[model samples]
Target: MMFAEGHGLHPGHENLGGHIRFFNLDSGIFVRVRLPLLTDHCVLDSVEGLLVLQRDEDTAIHLLHPFTGDIVELPPLTSLAMQLKTDYTEATKLKLMRHISASISVADDGVVRVMVILIRMMRAAVATSQDTEWSMLSWRVPSHYQPLSTGGKQYLVHDTFFEDIDPDVAQVFQMEAHLQDTPKLIVTIPREILAYPVYLVECDSEVLVVGHNDMSFTHLAVHRLSDLVSERYVPVKGIGDKVIFVGGRALCVSSKILPPTTGNAVIYQHPRELTFSQYCLGSSTWSLATDECSMSMSGLTQGPCSLIPHVFTCCSRRHWNKGLMYWRDNEPLTWKVKQKFRDGVNHSHDPSLISPTRLFS
Candidate 1:
């Protein structure tokens, strides 16, 4: 799933193959575009009249009129420039500006809106906002395309590119039509926890993260997003695998949450020897799992959100699927530890486990 900040929406499609679903919370409408080909990339453009999809090199892009089911090519830049220069005249500027002002609502409310109008007038007086034949300039000219600042402001010139969108498509990041249609929200998560960030949906609940210094064993307490109630942390060596809670039960699941999969059999079987247990968000005492056994890297699947003492993950999978993975709950789901090998099957089997730091020091 890709999040578009400009549009204030998060749109995602299934990989391998799936339909596109656009959710605009403002409009309260979810639009679906079902195409025969996979979605490479999509933008809600305001260029007028067309919704375009340009695929990346990894996948071939197929464009179909979402409504008419007809194929259209993007207009050539050369012809498009000629048309914009010819039709966009002095009268068009006032009309476009009026439409633009009416369409946008600034963040500072009326104050910012008044300031922008003042700035526009100042620039126009100094021949900055409008001077020579900007409309006659190539679309690529910086003058032709207004600098899109940090707000929901878009500029519209003459309409030329829509002349023929039958066989050609332009690779673009932001589009006009889509931006005009959707309202977006920006959710900021800590960059450090981005890779394995877990999602929690609890109203007014606070997720706690505890940090322990490996050398001193001191506890550093951190409160996470209270609204969502999820905790994330970096794994430090020597912290035992366990999630503790203060007053509530903690919900833990397989390390994988996105696209929520089940039956970790996909990554189960021969697991890796876990050397560290990353202490993510948790309280001091994690609740007991239904099963009292230690959860290894081979067994976490789907379940209600709870606190896990510690979750285990494996990157290298030599025996099963490469990247075959699993999670070990603070408490085992079933009352059994079915590891393929016993802990002390061979005291002298592997040399890695015999290091001075591991065995003696």
Candidate 2:
């Protein structure tokens, strides 16, 4: 979890021009850095490994590569704030920016394309670094459904059905996505769980839907999405030594690839609350990571698929997009799943974590 301006800013943090704290979910690690971009800025979210920041004074947008100290500026969202409502303040505008699912792409010409989909409005805005204003994307989500971004793509998911919005595509971290790629419903929820809230996420390149087993949100249920099959979604029994982070972006990574730890578990942060919990699928167990835990995995300098950019600065715009999209992170996930949420026991979580879900959630 990355902490920055307005979010998890400590008492002394306000004085730092730019400051961020990093926490690793799995291994319980924390790192803090100070970088001055302006007087103050809120770390709104992150795209790939870049921090998406909103300047407090002007509401301008910026993409910050924390490690390399690179910043890309976008126009202030003042116009957007007015478009969303007739009467509002900076606080209200910042609230609208919460949980927004955004995707970004840098073309072969160094032009950066970013798509921002407001959560409550379900309205999309598209902008490029070369443009002066944001253009609206005609896609508006249905009233009851929710928009989710997994595997660098966005989707609108509800209890019964979910389909891909198929946001921006310019080749990400070495993954080749084509402009011709279209969005479609990869799976539908079973009638049994239709009453529960369902969400879509990509783990190890496999799309999965997670939801609660009951109205209490007591347990979690997971299933894999298989578009190639008839019914589409296959029930996932276990993630097999792999850990799933159910915060910000639902990242499912291998234990060997990051801060190593015991796997086959799900770590989640409550959206409406500041509580975080870890659920063990195998033992059907639960543990409290923190009482004031709010998982963000967003890099704040306050900023992996290692997030470490090897050739971001000097690479040629023409060929680097292709090369960067496929940057090597060869870790793999292995395990068998039964497609059902098992009932297990509980345990105490690691206390070393200040806000444990940094990397996992």
Candidate 3:
């Protein structure tokens, strides 16, 4: 699937962390693209085949479709930006803010909205396409995202990225789009959890959390946001024939959606480390994937929304299928993927040509 991958929203400003990474995850192979069109804006988050982007010129948020080139603009953050106290740290400065992640949704009425988390605020703010400016969120406890929008609600995962955080304190919230009602709570008291950080995901219309047992990430937890009146999390015994792919968005799909052998397991890609591993629920053990695209490297995170059914990606895949053998002066970006076996699966086509084959050999 196509997801935004980058260190921060500000492209090139945060120590060369500017720019977005779009990659695809088929049964197991990895194909990535570098967007030349999005070279300037900082991409904050993505969902449902739409990207939440921040304009470097004014920091206004936008929903962009990389393929159709459609754009939906939202109001500026003037109100939220003015909330920054002069004494705030430089990193948190409205202009220099780094580590800002955005999750978005579109109402049935065609209204667009977003929830943004800036490290400087230590809290999140919500706004919609109709709003004059941003509105600060007063969540009872700090809830964060890897947020997914489904069933007309936006879900925020707890902010477990805090250091020295109490392991017992974590929550998953069903956020109301209009900010009129108190958030619905799903408490998952992970007292037995380690410091490996937690993530929220939606699968089969149910919300779940992916946490680690310890620092190793070798042991993981996937619990359903309970449907019982208690509103607590329940352990998922087995995923049946579904495979959970955890990354920017925790996606659960049938093994048939990917390679035939990729089922009844949880595949995780470390958000920062970009490492991939699989844990089979049936086996209750971790093992290396032996699929065709078994192991590869991009040194970045993947998955948020949508899927592209192909092998090679150019700057935009702008003309990858056009059978073109010449460079379009504008499409200058190409990706290099390294396989674990040192097979060095580089796109060996003419550097300027749009290719469909996997073999550069």
Q: Per-residue lDDT tens digits of candidate 3, residues 1-361? A: 4432211122223332333444443344344334454544544455567766666455577778876678888766556767655685432355433344555667789888766665335556778888778876654325464466655466666655463666555666665555545667756445464234666666676776667756665677777666422654455777777777654446666666455345677766443332345778666787643332322223232232112112212112222211111111222223322121143322222123313231111
Compute the lDDT of residue 268 as modeled in candidate 3: 61
> 1-361 in candidate 2: lDDT tens per residue?
4432221222123344355555443454556666665235545555577777766566678888877889888877765665664365644554555435567777888888777766666566767787776665554543333444444466655342232342211111111111213234444455444224555556666766666665567777776645313554445778887767553235564555443234777766544433345677777777753322122222122112222111110011111111111111211000000100121111001111213232111
Model 1 RMSD to the real structure? 22.4
Model 2: per-residue Cα lDDT at residue 306: 28
Provide the clashing-pair count of each candidate structure: 33, 19, 4
lDDT tens readout by residue for model 1, 151-176: 23322111122435321211111212
Query: Which of 1 and 3 is the better model by lDDT?
Result: 3
- Candidate 1, which segments miss by more than 4 Å at Cα? 1-16, 24-27, 38-49, 55-64, 75-361
lDDT score, candidate 3: 0.51
Top of the candidates by lDDT: 3
